[model samples]
Target: MTIPEQIEAYLTSQPQAKRTDLRALHALMLQAIPGGKLWFEDGKNSEGKVVSNPSIGYGTRTTTYADGKTKEYYQAGLSANTSGISVYILGIADKAYLAETYGKTLGKATVTGYCIKFKKLADIDVEVLEAAVKDGVGMTGEN
Candidate 1:
């Protein structure tokens, strides 16, 4: 299936409340990065083993590994976790940016090196989240 279709299927498979939150977040991500490329990762490794939750991604970046191989991936990602949701902001040079800048202000969310996680949209400040996402996208030079 296409990325949008895969994302829809992933969201549809979520519990009702989580699905609602994910849908809202999906819209918010699009608004933050209009015309950004869309992506869907089925959380499978090359062997097709499930490695993580399915994720809906946005934007693009080229990443080079220590082994000298390079690959392109999303600049931001959204996924439903066992407890709630996670938004991954990639390409930040400073690992502390998210936590230092938005951790306390984001309400009941956990701000990690590249991820903002919360149980629901109502648990956090959407505006703060948006700002963080914007900053993240800027860090990747994706906007």
Candidate 2:
């Protein structure tokens, strides 16, 4: 299935959800970041189209960093019924130092070379989160 489809399926299978809240939160994350073609669309990896189990809501957006590295923001389906909302930042592998430093800001964050997954939007520190995004993918923020 496509990313949108995957999101739909996942959300539908959920026993409970806060759809508006989750979507708004996701949109806020995209808006808070800097330059790129922000989009609410599917993502393709070498493996094929990304999928969100049980329709949790999957999406991908692209952004450019200050150092000239481009980054992708990917979200898994809406999982308010199970794990809440998950937001992912790409290029973690290239931003290990940033992750190491800002990783503590969230208190509980899942780290990978190219991804940081947070169980809830509130768990993220907006300032630190922006800095990490800028540092990780090289996106410069407002003055």
**Per-model TM values vs. the true structure:** 0.96, 0.48
Model 1: per-residue Cα lDDT over 1-143, one tens digit each: 87888899988998899989999999999999889999999999999999998899888888899999999999899998888899999999999999999998999999899999999999999999999999999987754
- lDDT value for candidate 1? 0.92
Q: What local lDDT does model 1 show for residue 136?
A: 91
lDDT of each: 0.92, 0.49
Residue 21 accuracy (lDDT) in model 2: 48
Misplaced by over 4 Å in model 1 are none
Candidate No. with top TM-score: 1
TM-score of 1: 0.96
Candidate 1 residue pairs in backbone clash: none
